[model samples]
Target: MPYLFTCPHCQTRTEVEDEFSGQSGECVVCGRGITLPDFAPGASRPRNQAPGGSAGRRKRPAAWIAAAVVLLLIVGAGLIAIARVGGSAAQRVRQGRERMASIRNLEKIAAALNAYAADHGAYPAPAITDRRGKPLLSWRVLILPYLGEDELYDQFNLSAAWDSDKNQMQMYQTPAVFRHPNSQGWGSETAYHLVIGTGTLFPSTGPLGPKQVADGATKTLLVVEGRGASAWTEPIDIDAGATGGLINAASGVGLGGITDGGVCVVTVDGRGHFLSEATPSMTVNALITPRGGEPLPDDVLD
Candidate 1:
């Protein structure tokens, strides 16, 4: 049972349960002090009790207080849950921004490569060399000047061989542009990977006649990702083959092998697209023998 009480200080009225009669509380409406007298509900009044006659009532049940406490705890828990979820969302967005920046850097590198190619006839063979004409370093090594890392590029001892005891393949990390910020530490003998094929339409390993084309050069990938890895940055012994444009293994470097012929390839066009998945069996066989032509079924393209 509940009883109404009037606050003498501010003349405010408040309702309190019978059990809380001895407790004092502040008036919500007038900021005045209020005190309750214990009273029982529907009980006979004692002769000693003054005017109201019914002062003794059963006290408020304890169950109501417990329910209130549970409600408060539930609300507090909900707030904490919301805060954690918001924090995670923010982290994901930040990572996404970093990834975008890395991709853009790759785009700029591709453009530079194109400009270099335009100046020269074909993609400059992997690297520049001396009278012996052996590759002194990877093409990625040569592109440093064009990518605005002239000082860093000069630091490399071009005369030294890759993975030799002296250099230990440090040249592979020269180009900052070669690595994506999102890459969790994967790279190569060279900062960049190279795509090789007879400069022809639908390129096949055999002689490039006037009529061959590197398949999907525009749609295929040239290089999508490079972080850091065991493969030397220079043309490292992989046979030049037509692999959906990008030289990145059909999968990705350091990420594990990409079997789907198409890794996410960033094209000379400065656009990025996922290339068709190359059949794993076909790609593996191609890696061993560059000349084998099990032309991917047209369906594979679809």
Candidate 2:
């Protein structure tokens, strides 16, 4: 018959043969020295033994419980770290898709401008003014026919101001090319704008023909993506006089307002280009001019 015994050092229970009674040896589980009590075949219990030998078990030590808790905490922290990294990667992918959509919108607008230029000798003026010189409509309204929005354009009262009672209703009917995919807020406002000034393409004085761009059509900037949204018909755009430095997209200023650290622009040749925010202010100024006669370095376009 086998008798049960408990190891004092490790609290492990084991069965031993009756023949090993009264013998001294090392504990099987803990490797500690221990002695077995002598047993009589007919005796109900051992001479100096407790009522229940291994029937009732002892509770685990505090050390074991603490180790289990520590292991659980480590696993939880690892899971949280994985979740955060996954969320950041997903956000980056979403931003990249929006940037591509914005670029496509700029390309479409460039195509419309080119078509308009082909019919007319020069590009549209920054704004259309009445005989008294009061601003009425923006160049955005001038290219309506080329943009396949001739019906919407015909509804505008070109004689009255863009925000006039009749035209105000049409203000909410913004064209798809003017609104960026990532832009927020209400109204038919636009994120696309033109850099208008004395030497720029869309000058306040008058529109310039392709031949007038002495710097070459591909070198002159026609339109740019700006920060804030403006009513599509409003004569609002970037002022060359105000933009004296590089503007990053994160800053919501001049050049890089729509993309990360860069801005997408359409040149007079109907091609889109992404200009880094790190581009020198002088190089940007040269690109904006129609006939400044400044020599652009080969690396400036890179």
Candidate 3:
């Protein structure tokens, strides 16, 4: 006994044996799907048989109609699953590449800062302050031109406070160089942190001491990281007192794993290194204060 079937996806008529009913196969025309119900062995033919007696052949049309429906369902489900998986994979790859690009740009910014320092005496001071001695702007605003952000820097009103509620500042729109790509840290606004007066070698504004002479230029850390919620220009603290400057990641020293140059440090030698928590806690602390550290390992250079 043979049956005829149609593919739902392609609307192609197909034929299958009645004995093979309930069996599954791909449709030839649409190549979509197929299955047929099995017939009992020695099944009797219909009573109103014609002279040629082709009951099995007559049943083929109905069988094909059912097969078509099942095929379409399976094909649709498969397509949906593939699309979903592909979309997720593509997103992950894109994020990874973006993070890497941010990191590279930061490296370049670090180099530019070093060059600025070599020409000038100290790290650029926070933007000039108001008569009340309040800092009017961030230090980054001053170094914009040197970092190839000349156009952005020139647009800012040097005399105004960075957080001024006055006219909207364009500098805010330009991405700051300090924020790391991987840092999806909290706060809507965050940027790189400069450790001013934290370096022991880079002593506070005071007469140069022997310690400052030895480590100030070479041993002090120039930059670290902080949360976006924090004032990006403010030095980060290890403890509530903020007396401890160096936060180590391994020792969980300040705010846990923020020391040990855990804030990325770029030395005068133009080398960049991730300070380890394993490094001496005292060494990390000494490095942050003005005029207090030992020489860092040579390898920690850029």
Query: For each candidate, what is the lDDT?
Result: 0.48, 0.75, 0.51
Clashes of each: 34, 1, 32
List model 2 lDDT by residue over 49-168, tens digit each: 443343234433323323323444466578889999999999889977877787788778878877887789887877889999888888899998988999999999989898899899
- Candidate that beats the other on lDDT, 1 or 3, i.e. the better one: 3
Model 2 local distance difference test score: 0.75
Candidate 3, residues 113-232, lDDT tens digits: the string is: 666665675556534567886667666666667878787777777677666654145534545565555546543244355544434333334212322345655565554544444443
TM-score of each: 0.52, 0.74, 0.53
Q: Which has the higher lDDT value, candidate number 2 or candidate number 3?
A: 2
Off by over 4 Å in 3: 1-106, 183-188, 198-213, 216-218, 230-263, 293-302
Q: After superposition, how far is residue 119 of candidate 1 from its true place, in Å?
A: 2.2
lDDT of 3: 0.51
- Candidate with top lDDT is 2
Error of 2 at 298 (Å): 3.7
**Model 2 TM-score, 2 decimals:** 0.74
